[model samples]
Target: MLTHLALKDFAVVQSAELAFGPGLTVISGETGAGKSLLVDALGLLSGLRADSGVVRHGASRAELVAEFSLADAQPATDWLRENALDEDGDDGRHCQVRRVVRADGGSRTWINGRPVTVGQLAELASHLVEIHGQHEHQALLSRPSQLALLDAYARNDAERRAVAEAAGRWSDLLAERERLTAQGDVSDRIGWLEHQHAELERETLDADSLAQLSIDHRRSAHAAGLLEACERAFAVMDGDEGPSITRALRQARDTLQRVAEHEPRLNEVDTMLDNAAIQLDEAAVLLDRIRGDLDLDPQALEALEQRMGRLHELARKHRVTPEQLAAKRDEIATELEALRGADERLQGLDADIAAATRAWQAAAEVLGATRRDAARRLSSDTSALIAELGMGGGAFDVVLEVLETVRPDPQGAERVEFMVAANPGQPPRPLRKVASGGELSRISLAIEVAALGLDAVPTMVFDEVDSGIGGAVADIVGQKLRALGERRQVLCVTHLPQVAAQGHAHYRVSKSASDGVTQSEVQALGAKQRQDELARMLGGVEMTREARAAARRLLSDAG
Candidate 1:
């Protein structure tokens, strides 16, 4: 329920604050007195777009604030908690929304003193208040809205979900079938894949095999140079021919050992010669081993080069490097297997599509039945209300037009349209075609009243919805609004005295020009003040005795 609203430098209102409680609250004023300004303020706080034109002439910005009690608004409370915007006051039964609109047309919103995006604010506001503008009656003309309202009234969430899920399954299967059919024949593609697979399978593409092949190719390419160098080194170092490194080193070591007893320094030289002789012998052995292992066969070299060339060609054909050949081969084999089974899979798809279609039809049937039952009840109830709202002999009907299509529809099997006949013995037509704005307003109200508690919103605001209505009909409208207030907080802006008199709380908006600047003011009225305001509304500029008496009677009867 709305607890308070405050507006600062917004439109023609310089400043104003109003306190609200449970039950019907009405705002009324003379012509051009800015009675709807309060409603506009609430709308801004509800996340409506802002404009620079709404700012007062000299003000830099406009501020709007609204406070609601969450005691009865469990949905809103849960939303705040889930969003981490809840506070620890009143055990989390308090919420405050503030919006600031700058003169440049930019605006910002806050919930519980924490800044938020407009989308977030709108989401939170949905559970707190529902504002029905004077012109929002046109919303009833939309077929989708009519269908949604019926579903809401029927409480058919489970049925709707089932239908939607079944339709999704059917659509997915149909898409798969279409894809398979679009592929035409894959025989040629499959044959190409098999040929490529065979070519890749003949090659050794693993890392170890490629590395060893590279090594053998290098060794064969340098075989002649390696063999010649190894033989010369072995002959010069360890050979028995002429003077050699090993023989010279041994003679130098023996001569140094003989002088070691005479000079200690000569002993170090003898040890160096001995080490050099040992190193030469080890070098000759390694050279001999390498020369024996080297393969000088040209044919073997040619075979390794052929293998490398084939690997390169394959990599180029597949748009991959040699290192990726193994993975690419496996990928081709998998795709080839799948193509070979395409016909079999396509045959399976036909049965799957048929089963999905059956499931969707079954769910749609149940949903359609539920809608029909709800449509009948909603139509009968709204028709009775239309008559009560001074459209006697009027009839309202909910028409479910069966759709003709072979595909599954998520919205069930029918299209819903609201039909109405505003006079007795006349054929009902689409509600959208109703001529009079007054009749449309009344019908909208009638439907809302008929399905009042179906919505979970804690507050409802009606902005001059009683327009084009007066006298006893207006009185009935007022009574209905008051009754609606019994279950939900209602704020109504009206010019009708009959409607004003029904409010448990009343406020009057008045404007005055001060130093060439016009400002609007709002004041909550007491019994005497409320009576006078009603008299003014009833009798216009002059306060007539008869009008005061009528106002008093209206209030007495309303009590």
Candidate 2:
């Protein structure tokens, strides 16, 4: 429920604050007193588009703020939590929405002090408030909105969701089957993929195999250079031709061992020379082994070069690196398998599509049954309400137009249209074509009352919804709104005295001008103030004794 609203530099309203409570709260004022500005502020907070014209004259921007307690608004609380917009300290039991429209036709929105997009604000506000403008009867003319109202009245969320899901699955299966059929025969494509996969499979494309192949290729290409280096190294280290390293080391060790008897330091030198000789001998043996392993075979080298050339050519052809050939082969093989089994899959899809169609029809039938039941009850109740609201012989009807198509439909198998006959002995026609603006308002109010505010939105604002009625009918409108307030918070903007007198709380919007600057102010009236306001509404510019007495009678009767 909306607990508070504040406006600053908004149209003729400059800095105004209003607190609201449950039950019917009425806002009344003389002509051009800005009575509807409060409703406009709420619309902006509900994420309506804002322009510079809404800002007060000479003001830089217009600000609108609304606070709602989420105690009874579970959907709103869950939305806030899901969007991470809920405040911390209050356990998300309160929500504050603020919007500012700049003079340059720019606007910004915030929820709980965090900046948000207008779309997000609108989505959250849908669970918090529902506004019915004076012209909202136009919405009743929309077929989808009408269907939504019927479904809401039925309270069949699960059933509607089931129908939508089944329809979606059916549609998807049909699209898949169409695509497969459109492809005609894919044998040629399948043949191409099979050949590509076979060609790739002929090569060793694994990472380890490719790496070893590269190493062997490099070694084979340089085998001549390696053999020359190994033979030269072997002769220089251990060749017996002249003054070899091994011969020199042995001579040095023998001289050092003889001198070790005179000085112990000579013994250390002797041991070092002996270790050096052993290391040189081992290195020479390794060099001989490497020389034997080296092969200068040109044929082996040419084979490696040809293999590498083929890998590169394949990489370019496939638009991939040589290392990716194995993955590419697997991908082609999978696709080939799918294409080979295309005929079988198409047959399977036909069966699946047929089954899905049956499922959707079944779900839609169940939903349609629920709607038919709800529509009957709603039509009966609305007809009674229409008669009570001064349309004595008026008749209301809900016509379900059942569609005779085999295709799955998310909205069920039928559409709803409200029918009405505003006069006795007249044939019923579509509400959109037969009802005038005022009659539409009354009928709209009747439907809402009959539905008993079944929607989950906690707040319902009616802006001048009672515009075209007076006298007893106006009184009945007020009573009906008050009755609705018993279940949902209702805010009414009206100029009728009878409607003003029916409020649990009353507010008067008065306009004042100074220095050619006009401003509107909203005041929550006390008991005496309310009476005076009602009296003024009853008697015009001046309050009369008779009007005051009548106002008192109204209050007494309402009590």
> Each model's C-alpha lDDT?
0.87, 0.88
Model 1: per-residue lDDT, tens digit, 214-258? 888788888898888877777777654568888778888877887
Which portions of model 1 miss their true places by more than 4 Å?
A: 1-11, 14-25, 37-133, 136-138, 207-293, 453-459, 468-479, 482-490, 496-507, 516-518, 523-559
Model 1 global lDDT (CA atoms, 0 to 1)? 0.87
TM-score of each: 0.72, 0.83
Report the number of the highest-TM-score candidate: 2
List residue ranges in candidate 2 displaced over 4 A: 8-11, 41-129, 136-138, 239-289, 433-435, 468-475, 496-498, 501-504, 516-518, 535-559
Residues forming the 10-long window of minimal summed lDDT in candidate 2 = 133-142
